[model samples]
Target: MKLFLYVLSLVGFLAGCGGGGVDSIADGDPSYVKVRESLREASSRVLDGLRIRGSYQAEDVFHVSGCESDSKEGGGKLWEAAHFWQIDEVNSGEVQSSIDRLRDSLEAQGWTIVDFARPPQVKNTVVRAQDPKAGYVVRVIGVQEKSRVAVRVSAPCFRASGDS
Candidate 1:
C-alpha cells in the first residue's frame, strides 16, 4: 500500500509538468489585458469596426531564452511569453486600406512607426510600431492579395520566477 501511494504521488507530480496548468503566459503581466484591448481598438478601426477575426490566440511560456520549448505543448520555465492573432477572409483591396488606416491611427496616437516593408516575394504589407515609453511593440501584417492580416502585441521582457 505504501509503495502504491508513493508511485501515485510521483505520477501526479510528473503529470503536472509541461502543462499550461502550472503557470499562465500572462500571469505577471499587469498591462497584458490593457494592451490587448488597445490592439482590438486600433485594429477594429481598420477592419471596419469588426472585432478580431477568429478570436484565435497562441500563447507560450518559455523556460529558456532564445531557445525552443522541449515539449510540443509549450511549457517551460515561464521566462518569456507571447501572444498572436490572425485575421482572414478580407478583400485584397480592403487589406491595403485597413493597413493604411491602422498606420495612421497608430501614428496619431503617438506610436512611432519603426518599420514598413512590402517584400516583392511576399504580398503582405507589414508595419511595425513602438510606443513612446517603449513598453510594448506592435506589428501589423496584411496580405492584400490574400485578404489576410495578423497582429502581434508583445509585452516587455522580464524574468519569471518559475512560480504560478
Candidate 2:
C-alpha cells in the first residue's frame, strides 16, 4: 500500500512540471499571424532596453504541441505559440551591461521579473520576465563562453487558429 501511495503522489507532482494543473487552460485565438506578431513585438520591447544590439532572427516556431486544457475529459488539444530570436555578434564583455539595460527595459515595459541569475550569484546568466495582463513571457539567456544570446517570447496556451 505504501508503494502504491508513493506512486500516486509522484504522479500528481509530475503533472505540474511545465506549468500544469487545473489552471493550465488554453485561450482561443482566431488569427495565428496576429498572435505571432504580438509576441515578436513584446520581445522587441525587452531587447530595446539592452545596451548592445545584435542580429535578431526569428525562430518561427508556431504550434508547440503542449498547450492544452487540463480538464478531466481532455476535450481539446491546444498548442502554445512561441517566437525566438537569436542575437549573434554580441561579445562576452557586453553581457553584463546588456543585462542591466534589459532589466530596466523590462520594468519600463511593465513586465514582472520571474527569474534572474548572474555571475557571482551563479555561473550562467538568465533573465525571465512575464506580462501578466497579456499572458506573454520573455526569456534572455546568455553564456559568457558562447558569445551569443537567445531571446524567446512565448504566448500562453492557445488553440490553433483552426479552432477559431
Q: What lDDT tens digits, residue by residue, belong to model 2 across residues 1-164?
A: 22332333234323332233343323333454466557646655755667575544333233344565533445455656666556667877887678777977887778899999888898767888888888898888876777777777788865544443
RMSD of each: 13.1, 13.7
lDDT of 1 at 13: 29
Q: Estimate each model's TM-score.
A: 0.54, 0.70
Best by TM-score: 2
Badly placed stretches (over 4 Å) of model 1 are 1-78, 119-122, 161-164
lDDT tens per residue, model 1, 2-95? 2332333234323332233434334234433343334344433334422234322222112213223223344434233333445667665666
Worst 10 residues of 2 by lDDT: 1-10
Colliding residue pairs in candidate 2: none
Q: Provide the lDDT at 54 for model 2.
A: 58
Task: Report the C-alpha displacement of residue 41, candidate 2, in angstroms.
Answer: 0.9
* lDDT computed for candidate 2: 0.62
